[model samples]
Target: MPDTSSYLNSLPAIFSEDPFLGQFLLAFEQVLTGLDAAKDEPKQGLEQTIANLSKLFDPSAIDTLFTDDEKTLKAFLQWLSGWTALSLRADWDTGQQQRFLAEIVPLYQRRGTKENLAQLLKIYTGLLPIIEEAPDRPFQIGVNSTVSSTISADTAQIGGGTPHRFRITVTMKSSSTDELARQRQIIQAIVDLQKPAHTYYELPILIRTDTMQIGSRSTVGVNTLLGSIPTA
Candidate 1:
């Protein structure tokens, strides 16, 4: 059993560097404080602990973590597995609960690559299985036209000279058949918006409807589309 006190020591190092995650860590601390107060049934207390941790990431939060440190994010998931066993003690098969708890506790002790990235991968697959090495993978932001062009009924204009529908195409690599069509749609949106340079745009707005696959089952999940519209 870890002293739990020792875990506090890692805080300064972790917090000093990552303010946003540090604030999240503070919230985690509050959950611990609550756990201490509910010392009656380790089971019930554990359930509360799990609930609090779940709050740390409300589904969508996983996307944010993947966008940052995926490895660390995966390592931290051991805590989630342990919390689950504790939370389901009464309802789950007693043997299964004990087995899961035994398996996951060690992970919290030594986070980072060594503990068991495989197990973590299995656990987080449902949450963010398709984490991209880069944001909007497959379709990365490539060299877009620095200049804009337009064509009117009478003549054509270049570089912001006139208002013409300029078609901008963002290519997404390794896209699945299902996503390839949608990727084109999203890129078209970028052309339609006529946005300026250096901004993040939520593309493929219709992409949420696509059914996501688990693990390496689907390669196309990571592609994304973006459009660059010059102000000039």
Candidate 2:
């Protein structure tokens, strides 16, 4: 049998062509570090701190806890989705505030630009503790590409330029962690695979997700991210 150690050692070299994967690993490390910072603080007035954050970022779900005027749902979403950094006050112990912030990390859906960027930094801070307990392993990944060549280059050309396009497929696999990890990995991989530099000469890669079942008979359901890239 081939030496497993050698194969494992070779993964980094084999993956060198895709340097962006390294960036992802670094980003994930940052996320883990953030979680650690959130856990070191003490707890005092934990409940109130949670309540304040609930009103600010997760108002849609926390709205029932307070009156209408107290709901900052729309504004919070906008703030997170925008491109600015966001700061909030905490009256409770550090752990409690961290937990509450972790729970509301899903508010990223509502963020748009820089505000959303700020929200991400806050989340990274809060998620640091949870990562400390987990072991980091070599992440496994797979890639596939397909192209349609039936379209004639001459017929598909635009304004005497390159042909319009064909189709490209990018299939990937990653071990599941939490739901957030799974979703984030998939999105990042798709973006990396389909960047315009890669796609201008090549067809766009479509990311596909799949599920697997274990035990006696296995089951699986595969799906694609919602929106489609325009072919050019």
Candidate 3:
């Protein structure tokens, strides 16, 4: 009100008279100019921070991570490690890890049981396991067998280890040697993780060979590869 234009015009002279005041005014002017320019367009840093915060609050945004067909589930598993309370292995496939995470509550509920062990094996290997308890018998002579007879007790032992013994027989249709080797690695990994620390397991992978179809157009007989032919 008191000659505002003249007072404003006198500011430069007043600032110039005091060097510290001039530097302070110059910095304050720069700050005001920057804020004015910021008003013309959105601040990229602030907008990006807000966008990230919005994503964190949105459930659908998080769901997109688990719903993605490829890497999302794997990433979710890594995030859920603390919540799931499971020691996840890197060698396990993403699907296997996800299944483990999904069933972790139930598996922990039934931990150390035959059902839990079988479920764990199935989750990792996609094959049902046969759990046998006390599969080994002590070798001894039978009282019913005669001492002089040629047919003795027929002492033969198969699996002798801890009371817990699980056998997983995988019958694969793949004839590729590489496939078989890969399957063995998969089986070994599953066994190492799924089995109890003191338990022993037998993973016998059997390759299935189909018989040839004999027809009028092709009458050639299939030859066996691994054994000697019987002589009549």
Candidate 1: Cα lDDT at 30:
43
TM-score for candidate 1, please give it.
0.21
Give the whole-model CA lDDT for all candidates, comma-separated: 0.36, 0.34, 0.51
| RMSD, one per candidate, in order | 21.2, 27.5, 15.0
Clashes of each: 2, 27, 0
lDDT of 2 by residue, 1-232 (tens): 1112222234657664565655445433333322223333332234445556645544344444334643354344345434333333333333333344544455546443333433443343322110011112222223212122332211222223233322222232333447445545443443343333323322222232333223211212222233432322
* Tens-digit lDDT track of model 3 for 125-163: 555554544334443446232222111123233333235
* Candidate 1 local lDDT, 1-232, one digit each (tens): 1223333557566545544564455444544543344334442334455655654444334334345665554444444444644232233333343344555556545433312433433332211112111121121124332222222122222332322212221323344777666545434342233233332222222222233434212233233322322221
Q: Give TM per candidate.
A: 0.21, 0.20, 0.44
Q: Which should have the higher lDDT, number 1 or number 2? A: 1
Error of 3 at 74 (Å): 4.0
Deviation in Å, model 1, residue 71 alpha carbon: 39
Give lDDT: candidate 2, residue 28: 36
Worst 10 residues of 3 by lDDT: 216-225
